[model samples]
Target: MKAYSKLTREELQTLVHELKKEYSRYQSMEMSLDMSRGKPCKEQLDLSMGLMDSLNSDADMCCEDGTDCRNYGVLGGIDEAKVLLSDMMENNPANIIIYGNSSLNVMYDSISRSMTHGVMGNTPWCRLDKVKWLCPVPGYDRHFGITEYFGIEMINVPMTPTGPDMDIVERLVREDESIKGIWCVPKYSNPQGYSYNDETVRRFARLRPAAKDFRIYWDNAYGIHHLYDKNQDYLIEILAECKRAGNPDLVYKFASTSKITFPGSGIAALATSSNNLDDIRNQMKHQTIGYDKVNQLRHVRFFGDIHGMVEHMRKHAEIIRPKFEIVEEIFSKNLGGLGIGGWTKPNGGYFISFETMEGCAKAVVDKCKKAGVKLTGAGATYPYGKDPKDSNIRVAPTYPPIDDLKTAAQLFTLCVKLVSAEKLLAERTGEAPEKAEAQA
Candidate 1:
C-alpha cells in the first residue's frame, strides 16, 4: 500500500472511490456495533464469578481482626482489606484507604474535598481566583472531565512513549502558582498504554511545584493489567518514591479491582502519606460511617492474597490479549505503511491510541458512525474535548465480541483511508474533494 501523501491525485481519487464502496457495503449490513468504551465482555467478567460464592450464608463474615463484615465501625476499612489492597497498590497497608466500587468516585471526591475544605488546611480551591491542572495529552478523558467539572483551567502536556513531556510538566508546575495538580495514569496508561520510565517517575517525585498544595493525582488503574507474563511493564512505586524525596504528601495514589473483577461492583482504594490520609479522613468521617465492609471481605476472601490476584489477572490477559492483538493486526494490514495514521500496540490497558493525519480524526470517526459503528469521539483523549491537531482517536476493543470487533476494526480502517484520501485529494487539487469533482 502506498502512503496516501505520496499518491498522485488520480491515485487518491481511485482509492477513495473503492473505499467508499467498501464502506457502503458495511453500511448496508445495518449493524449496531459499538467500540466507544473500554468494558470487559461477558466472557471476561465470567472469570470472576467465583466472587459471588466467595461469601455465602454459611460464611463466618468476620475479617482477620475479628471485625464483623456486617458492622459499620471500620471507617477507613477492615485491616485485612488494607493488606490485600496494599499489596495490589504496592504501598504500606497503613497508607491505604478502601473506598467503594469506583476509583473515579474516590478521585471525584478528592477534588471536591479540596474545593470545599482545601488540602491539609490550605485555602479552599473554590476561594482561589484560579486553579489550573496539567493534563497529559493522549491521556484519559475522565481525568480531564474531573478537573473541568471543578472549573480548573487545564493545560495540555504532550505525551511520549516514556510518559508525559517531563520538561513541560516541571516548568509549568514550577512557575505557575495556579497549577494545583496533574492527573497521571503512570502504569499501563489509559489510551497509550505507555508506562512512565524511571526518570519520569523520579522527576515527578522531585517536582518543585509553586503551589504548596500541589499534588500528583496518580491513578494506577491498570497497574496489574499485564497482557503478557514475561513481558510486563513495571512502574516505580510513587508513594514510596515521594516519601523518600521528603515530599510525603506530594501524591494521592489510587487503584481498584474495577477492571480486575467486576466493573462497577469491585472495591477501590487510595494510598498516600499519613498527613494526607489524616486530612482525607477528617472529611471522610462526615461522609459516611463506612463503605461496604461485606464487599471488602468478599474480595479479600475471593482473591486470598496478592498472589491469587496476580494469577486471576493472568486469566483476564488470556481473554483480552487476543482482542488487542486482533486490533493491532487489522490496523497493520489495512493502514500499516500508508502514512495516513498510526496506532499504539500496548502491552496492557484498555485502549489503543490512534493518530490520524492532521485534521482527519473527526472525519474518520464520523464516517465510522455513519456506517453503523460507534467509537470514542475524536479529541476525547485530550482535555476539554479538543485535540489541537484534530488528530488522535481512542480505539476500545474489549467491549465487543471478537467477531464484532473485527468488523468494527475493518470499518474503522476503511473510514480512515476514505477520510485520509479525501483530505489528501483536496489538498492536491486546491479544493474540497466534492467541489473539485464537480469542477472536473
Candidate 2:
C-alpha cells in the first residue's frame, strides 16, 4: 500500500520480482488483447442496426423540401439532415453544412482549402513566409497530423484540468500573426475526456488575436457521448459564445455521428458563422455536387430528432460504460496511492488517459506489447507523436469485449508496475549514463 516513490530499493526489488512473476503468468496464457483505438464494440454497433433498417425499398426517398434523396443537387445537405445535425451540433440550422462520413475528412479539406486559396479571401497560407498553429499538449494526433502535413509549425501549449492553458493561448495568438489556429476537442477531448469549463470557453471566445484570419478549430466530437445519464460534462456552445464576445467569425466547429451511428457511414458537419459558412461553401461547391443524401436521410429517419439521438446514445453508454469502469477499477485496485501512475475517470468519452512516471511510458507500452497486450503507443497523444515528458498513454477500452478488456487491463497494470519499478531503480542506482558518455 506504500507509494512506489517512497519505497526503498530493497522493497522495490521485491515488488518488481512479484510483478515479473505475475507478468510471466499472463505471458504464458498467450493472451492477445488490444486497448489501442477508441472504436465501438460489436454490441454497441449492433444497437445501431436500426439505422440500416430506417431506409428500405419500401421507404419514401424524399426530403421535406421535396428534394429527392437520390439527387445530386443539394450541395451542403438535404434540409432535414441539416436540421438534425444543427440541433446535434447546438448551432443554428442556417450555419450548419453537412458533409460526408468523416469529420476528419472535413477538417482536412478545411485546411487544404485554406492552403490553396485562402480563408474568406485572406492570403493563402502556402503563400505566407511562415505559418504556425497552437497545439494543446496531450492532444489528438490526427489534428496535429493535418497541420504538420501543411508544414505549419506547431507550438505546444499545456492543458490544465479546465482546458488548454488560455493565458498562454491568448498571449501567443495576440503576439504572433502567424499563429493562426488551435485544435480543440472542447467537450470530452480525445484522451483525457475533459470538457472545457465555462470560463475556459469564455476566454477562448474573447481572445484578441493578432491575425484577422485566426480561428479556433473546435472539434466537439463527443458532445453527447456521455457514459452516465445522471452525471455528464457540459460545454458552452463556442459559436454562440464567440458571437456574444463580438468575434462571430472566430471559430469553425465540427461534429459527426461517427460514434453515434456508424463511423464510416455517418454524417459530418461544420457549424460556424454565416460568413465562414459562405466562404467554405464557395470552395465546397467546386469539390462535390453533393454528399451522400441517402445516408443523411437514413440517419435523420432513424434518430428523428436530437432527443432520439440522446436516447440512442444512452444505449451506447450502457454497452461501453462497463468497459470504462473495468479500466478504472483495475487502475484503482492496482495503482491507487502507489504514485506509479495516474489516470482520468471520464464522464463521457471513448478514452482514459494515463500518465506514467516522467520517462516510463514508452517502456510500459513496450512491456505490454511484449506480453501480447497491445496499447496506444507512447507519445501518441501529442503532436508529432512526441510527448515531451514521455508520460501520457491513452487507453481505449471500447473496441474489445469485456472479458478481453479485463485481461488487457490486468496486463496493462502489470506492465505499468514493472516499468515504474525499473525506472525507479535506475534513478535510485544512478544507472542512466549522461549523453556525452553515450556518444563516447
Candidate 3:
C-alpha cells in the first residue's frame, strides 16, 4: 500500500508490467461493459411498477380543483400535482410549475426564453454583444451543454466541499454586468455528491450581482436521493434563503421523480418566487395549454405524497447501495495509497468522481475502453468538455450489474495504475507528451 509517487523508476516499471497482464486478460474477455451514464439499473426501475396501476380505465380523473385531468386548462399544473411537487421541491404550491417529463427540457426552455425575451425584462441576451455564465467546475455536463448551446461564454469556478469558491464568485458577479446566471447542483451534486453548507447557501443568497437579471439555476436533482436511511445530506432551501436575503427572485430550483420512479416518464417541476413564476407564466402560457396531467395524476396517486416517494427511494437504496460499496471497496483495496490519484465516496447521488495523475485521465479511459469497458469521457465534468488538469473522470456505477461493476472497477483501477506508472516513468526521464491523448 505504499504511495506510488514514492516508488523508484524500477518499481513503477514492475507494477506497470503486472497491470498490463491484468489489462490484457480483460481485453481477451471482450467484455463490453459500460459505466458511463447515471441510469438506474433494471431492479431499481422495477420498484415503481405500481405507477402503471395507479391509473387505469376506471380511476378518478378530476383533480381537486375541478379541472378534468383528461382535458387541459391548468396552465401551471393540476392542484394535486402542484401540492405533491411543491412539497418535494420545498416551496409553496403556488410557487411550483410542474413541467413535462424532463427537468432538462424545462432548463433548456428557460435559457431559450431568456435569449429571446430576457429575465424579468432585462435586455434580451441574444441582442446583447456578449452574454456570460458562471459554471462550477467538476459540475454537471448537461448544465454546461445548456449554456454552451446558447452561445454563452462559460467561466469555470472551482468547487470546494462546501461549495464553489464564493470569494471569486462574489467578486466576478459584483464586477461583471454580462454574467447573467450560474448553474448549480446545490445538493448532493452530480459527479461529486457534496452539498453546500449553510454558509454557502447564505453567500449565494447575498450575492450582489452587477446584472439585475443575475440568477442561480439551482438544480437540486438529488435532494432526496439518500443512500442511507439515517445519514443524509441536508441542503438549506435556496428559495427561502433568497427571500430572507431580500433577493426573492434570485434563484430557480428544479427537481423530479426521475430517479425515484421513472426517468423519461417522471414529473419535473421548477420552484421560484411568485414574481418569477408570473414572469415565466407570461411566456409559458404560449408554450402549451398544459403538460400531461394524467401522468402527473398517476405519479401523485402512486406516491400518495412526499413520504411515499421517500420510502420508494429507500427501496432504491437497498438495491443499489451494495453496488456503490463494491466499487468503493475495490478502489480502496487497489489504489488506497497510490498518490497518483484520488476519488469521491458520496453518500447519495449517481456518480463517483475519480482523479488520475495530471495528464493521465484520457489515457486511463482509453486503456479501459480498449479493454472493452466504457466510462464517462475524461473531461465531461467540466465546461466545454475540457478539464484543465486532464484529470477528473466521473465513474457511474448505478447502471451495471453489481458483479459486472466490480470487474469493471478492477479493470478501471488497473488502467489507472498503468497510466500513472507510464506518466511517472516519463517524468523520471524528463519527458512529457507535448500533446495529451484525447478520449475518443
lDDT at 219, model 1: 96
- The TM-score of candidate 1 is 0.98
lDDT at position 15, candidate 3? 72
Question: What TM-score number comes out for model 2?
Answer: 0.97
TM-score of every prediction relative to native = 0.98, 0.97, 0.97
Segments in model 3 whose C-alpha atoms lie over 4 Å from true places: 432-440
Instruction: Rank by TM-score, highest first.
Output: 1, 3, 2
Sort the candidates on lDDT, descending order. 1, 2, 3
lDDT of 2: 0.89
Candidate 3 lDDT over 1-440, as tens digits, reads 68888888778667767766777788999899998889999998899899999999998898876778999678888888889888888889989999888999988998999999999988989999999999998999999999998899999999999989999999999999999999999888888888999999999999999999998999999988889998888888888998899999999888888888899799899999988999999999988999999999999999899999888889999988899899999999998887878998888999888888889999889999999899999899999999999999999999999879989999999999888877776666555632111110
**lDDT of the candidates, in the order given:** 0.92, 0.89, 0.89
- Tens digits of per-residue lDDT, candidate 2, 279-321, equal 9999988889999999999999999999999999999999999
Best-fitting candidate, scored by TM-score? 1
lDDT of 1 by residue, 247-286 (tens): 9899999999999999879999999999999999999999
Error of 3 at 238 (Å): 0.8
What does the lDDT come to for candidate 3?
0.89
